[model samples]
Each structure stands twice: as structure tokens, then as C-alpha cells.
Target: MNKAKNVTISVYSILLFSIALYTLATLIYSLIPNIPVNKLFAMIVAFTILYLYIQRITLERIIILLFCLFFSIYTTIISEYSSDNINDLLWIVTTVLIIGIASDQKFRSGLEQAIKRNKKWMKMIIIVIELILLMAVITPSSYGNDVGWGKDASYFVGFATHSHTLASACCLLIVLIMTVYKDKKISLMEYAYYILPIYSILFSGARTFLISVLILIMINVYMKKNSKLMRNMTLLVILSSFIFALFNSSMISKFEFTSNNVYAKNMLDSITNGRSEFWKYDLDLFFNSNFFIQLFGRGFEYIYNYNYLKVGIKIWAHNDIINNLISIGLIGTLGYVYIWFKYINNFFKRPRIDFSKVQFIIFMLFTLYIVAPMLLNGLYQYQHYIFSSVLLGQLISQRD
Candidate 1:
């Protein structure tokens, strides 16, 4: 039994390491411009690692697998055999399978232990890579989105595919730091390391990422130091004030705020950053669809094509709920919500009054890093989802 447990730990550690390697390869590919095989090679490797463990199944795993199988067949029957559809189908299969494996109690237990054993180096390596990526900000991407709408490439994409990607990656890295450190006090220098990722998110021009990370930090600190209520509250208040001032500062003000860009003509547009328009479109499609489409929904490729045709540009509903409604339909969305309910229930079933526990910390991190971003930015297909699935699994594995 001990040998089996050790073997489980070792295998999980290898899987985590494989994911880290894939992420590193992605970062390198971003830096080196035209790599021969490209980032897909790394993604394929990571997926292959997870795919090999598919035989480790449970009732939940079977349901998730069936969900994927149903959608694949439904898509094939209804949609054309286009590359976009095929790629979307593959992505759905991969994501659900990852979540399925993560939902397994045994797998989650092994992975949680693996993360605990290796988190120190994991935190250090991720922060170092984050710093490296930040330095690359000076060398702008050839096609970085111009927040000014035509003025210049002011958004700091750094070495990422987009500004949002860099910001999102930084948020995930911060989660790693929180998970490893837990409620432990650290030196001033270690605290300063937190600023590096925060700064990266600020410059990346992802408004949602910035807000979410700040909230995450405050919540994390508050939970850990809640015993000293007054002191921690004071600290969080001061931190919030500083962040508010930083946004209003002259330096940050120079770059046009994403919401204040030329595209936003009115108050509602500015507040939503034009996402309301996309959401409205998606909602209309959902409401107007026939029974079959409403029940199973059109696939993501269909949404992409629909958006392109209607708007003359490719745009997704930035919100996941709406995105899922139109892309996967009511039944599929309900299935997804069911999975979320199960995982969420698992996390909260045995809440520790001492929120500093690693399981609780991981739950918070997953909520902030994965759930929030996916809901706000339609990041269901984000690269970080791979790693976040492990976090989700870890959260679900907790029994007490």
C-alpha cells in the first residue's frame, strides 16, 4: 500500500512537471517568433501525458467522457467537417478529459500530495519565468492590439500571444505563490517578489486580470491574518487605496484605459468594454434557435462563424455563461453547471475555520485564477486551464 501511494505521488509529480515544461516551451516559442514545430508541439505533449492516464476512471469520469462523446457525434452530424470544427471538437474532448481525471478521488489525492512536495521549486521557477517574461515587454509584439484603436501598440503583450494572455498567466502564477506559501509569513524580499507579477498584470492592459488579482491578494491576506482583524483590515484598506491611486496616476493614465477606448461611445459600452454587445448577440442566438440547437447548442466553431458573418469580424461572447449557452446549448450548459456544483460542494462540504489550509487556499486560487477569468473573459479554452484543472482536482479530492 505504501509502495502504491509512493508510485502515485511519483506519477503525479511527473505529470505536473510535464505541464510546467509545456508552459515553458510555450513561453520560449513566444519569444523566438518562428519556431519550426510551434507551441502546438508542446500542447500535444502535455495532452498526451494526461491522455495516457484516461484508463483511471470513475462514475464521474464516465459521465464526462459521455458528454464529450455526445457532443463530438452531434457536431459531426450537424456541422461540416471543417478544420475549425475539428479543432474545437478536439479542444472539448481534451478539456473534459482533463476535468474527468481531476474529478477522481485517488488521482486528486496523489496530485495534491505531489503539489505539496514540489511547490517550493514550482513557485520559484514560475516567478523567475514571470520576471523573464516581464523583461520582454520592451520588445513589443508585431501584432499587439492597439488599445488606442489606431494610435499605437501601447498595450503590453510582452512575450505572450496577447496582453490578456500575459495578465492571465501572471494571475495563475500568483495563485501558485499563494498555494505554496499558504498562511506562512515570509521576509520582506519574498513579499516584494509578489510585486513583480502584480506589475506584469498592470502593464499587460487586462483590466479584469488586474482587478481579480488584487481581490485575490486581499482575500488571501485577510483569511490568513483574520485573527488580527483590525491590523489586517487596515492593511487591506491601505492596499486598496494605493491601487486606486496607481490607476489614477499620470503614468498609467497615459495609456488609454481599455474601457475608455474609441470603441466605447456610451456609458454602458465603457463599463462593459463592449462585451455587452457580444453577449446580447449570443443571447439572441440562443433564444431564437430551434429545439435541437437550444437543447444541444451549436458548437464553438459555429459561434465563431456566426459572429464573423454577423459582425464582419471574429468576436466571442466574453462571458462564459452566454458563450456556453450559444456554443453548447441548454442541456450541455446544465451538465457543466452540474459538474461545477459537485466540485464546489466538495470544496465547501468540510470547510475549515482555519482557512489557511492548503486545500482551502487551492480552492480560492482555483476560483480566482480559473473560474473568475473563464466567466468574465470566456477563457474556457485558455492555456492555463490545463494547470487549473489540477488545482480543481486537488480541491475536489479533499474529504475533510
Candidate 2:
């Protein structure tokens, strides 16, 4: 029985490590811009899931996975079935299966125990992520030119398709590091690890993530009293440096503070960065459509088929809520919202250790990072979903 348990734990460890590797590779592809890293990683993940399924078939896991698969198939059949739509459908199915596996009681327990036993490997993963981000920061590329820091320098995308994704990943990384740090006093090197990711988010020039990180830092300061001085000083330095960088870069020119009205107008414009226009167009399209279209949505290919804005941009709704409504209709949007609420409720209800107070706060902050821009952006990519699932699994794991 002990040997069997060891094997189970080893299998789970390998699964999680593979997921992390996939995420890292995806980030690297973003920086290099030539590799089909995500596709290759997706194939590996699919096979891993198949292996897990064949090794341990359970009624509950199958039911949940099938529920997600049903939606994927339904949406694909309803849409134009273009490569993009099919890829999206596949990603959704994969995400669901991964979440289902991570959430399984036995699997999650074994995974957590395996992780605890393999702290060095986990640390190596973090180191790899940090090194990749460092490489992205140093490497020059044309990415993020559209909404990134003006022509002066490209906003940091850091192995992500966009700045926002990088910011979101950074936010998630910070939360994970902080969760670990909360258990014990971390060295200055570890503190640097936390700072690097936060700095990367700032460098990305993603307003939503920057704002979320600020709020998180403030809350951390208030909640943690043991190392108050050092924490505040570090935060102060980070904020000061970020402000200095913004003023030195082209970002300052985008803001107008000549007067209160100008300041307000510019602030709104800067924050929204024309996203309000996208939202307005999406809302108009949704409202002006026929009953069936509005209720059931025009499918995922709606934006590609119908250009309500006439902007010629191939992308559809920029906002997650609006995108869901436009792509999946009202029915799907409600279900989407319910899933998030249920996840949050379940997370809070789970029994946790004393350290969970800090963990909960970090989780909420991460959720805000996920939820805030999602109001203006679409669903997070596959890597983000995997990272989120891992965090959720850790949170839901039985107390050690």
C-alpha cells in the first residue's frame, strides 16, 4: 500500500511539473516569437490527461469532464468551426479536464504531498520562470507596440501574447511566492523574487495589474505586522521607481493634468485606452440584434462575421463579460458568472490552516487581478487557467 501511494504521488508530481513546464514554454514562445511552443505543450498535456484518465477512471471526474466537453462540442458545432474556434473549444475542454483532475480529492491530496516532498523542484520551476521573464525584459522585440509603452520602448510582454497576460501571470506568480513566504521568513533573495515579478507587471504598463498589485501590497502591509518596516520600504521603493520610469518614458505624455477637467478626461482615457469605445460598440451590437441572437449569441465567430464597429480589427469583444454575451449569449454568460461565484464560495468554505488568512487575502487579490481586466479583456489563456487551477488545488487541499 505504501509503495502504491508513492507511485500515485510521483505520478501527480510529474503531471504538475509538466503543466508548469508548459506554462513556462508558452511564456518563452511569447518572447522568441517564432516557436510553436504552446501547440507542442498542449499535445503533451492532452496525452498526460489521457494517461491519467486511463489509469484511474472515475464516475465523478468523467461526469465533470463530459459537462465541459458538451459545451465545447456545442459551441464548435454552432460556430463557423474555423481553426481559431476549434482551438478555443479544445482549450476549454483541456482546461476543464485539468481542473477536474486537480480537484479530485485523491489526486489533489497526493499532488500536495508530492509537492511538499519536492520543494526543490518547485523552487527550480520558480527560478526558471524568473529567468525567462528576465530574458524577456532584456530581449528586444516589436511586441506590445499597439497598447504598450509608446514608441520609446515596448511594454514587457514576457513570453505572453500581450502585456495584460504578462501582468496577470506576474500577479499570479507574486501570490504564489507570497503564500510560501508567509509560512517562514524569507531571505533577501526571496524578497527580490517577489519584487521582480511585481516590477515586471509595472514594466508591462498594464494599468489594471499595476492597480491590483498596489492594492495587494497595501493590504499586505496592513495585514502583516512582523516585518512592517522592511515591507513598507520595499513597496515605497518599487512605487517610486515605477513612477520615475513612467515619467521618464512616453507614458507621461498620454496623461493630461493641465486642469481638473483635463485631468479627469485624460485619466479616464488613459485608464480605458479606448476600451470604452470597444465596450460601447459591443453593447450596441448586442442590444440592436434580434431576440434570438441576443439571447443565444451569434456564436464565437460573430465578431469575425459581423463588424459592428467597422474598425476592421479582427478581434471581437474586448471585455470578458461582453465577449461571453456576444460569443455564448446571455445563458452562457450567467453560467460563467455562476461558476466563478461557486468557486469562490467553495474556496472559502474549505477548512484551512492559520496561514490561510494571508493565503485567502492573496487569493482574493489574485481573483481581482483575474476579474478586473477581464471586464475589459477576454478569458485568460490556457497557461493562466492552468496556473489558476494549481492555486485553487493548493487552496482546496486538506490541511497539512
Candidate with the greatest lDDT versus the true structure? 1
Flag clash pairs in model 2: 27-159
RMSD of each predicted structure: 4.2, 4.8
* Model 1: residues with Cα > 4 Å off, grouped in runs: 36-55, 80-87, 101-104, 137-153, 223-234, 237-245, 248-266, 351-371, 389-400
Q: Go through the candidates in order and give each one's C-alpha lDDT.
A: 0.62, 0.61
Tens-digit lDDT string for candidate 1 (249-323): 322643445457555557776666666666667789999999988998887677778777765557667776787
Cα displacement (Å) at residue 361, model 2: 4.2
Across residues 143-203, which tens digit of lDDT does each residue of candidate 2 receive? 3566524444456666677776666667656645543444454357656786667766666
lDDT of 2: 0.61
* Superposed model 2: Cα runs more than 4 Å off: 30-35, 46-63, 95-107, 141-153, 158-161, 172-182, 215-270, 288-295, 304-309, 351-363, 392-400
What is residue 175's positional error in candidate 1, in angstroms?
1.8
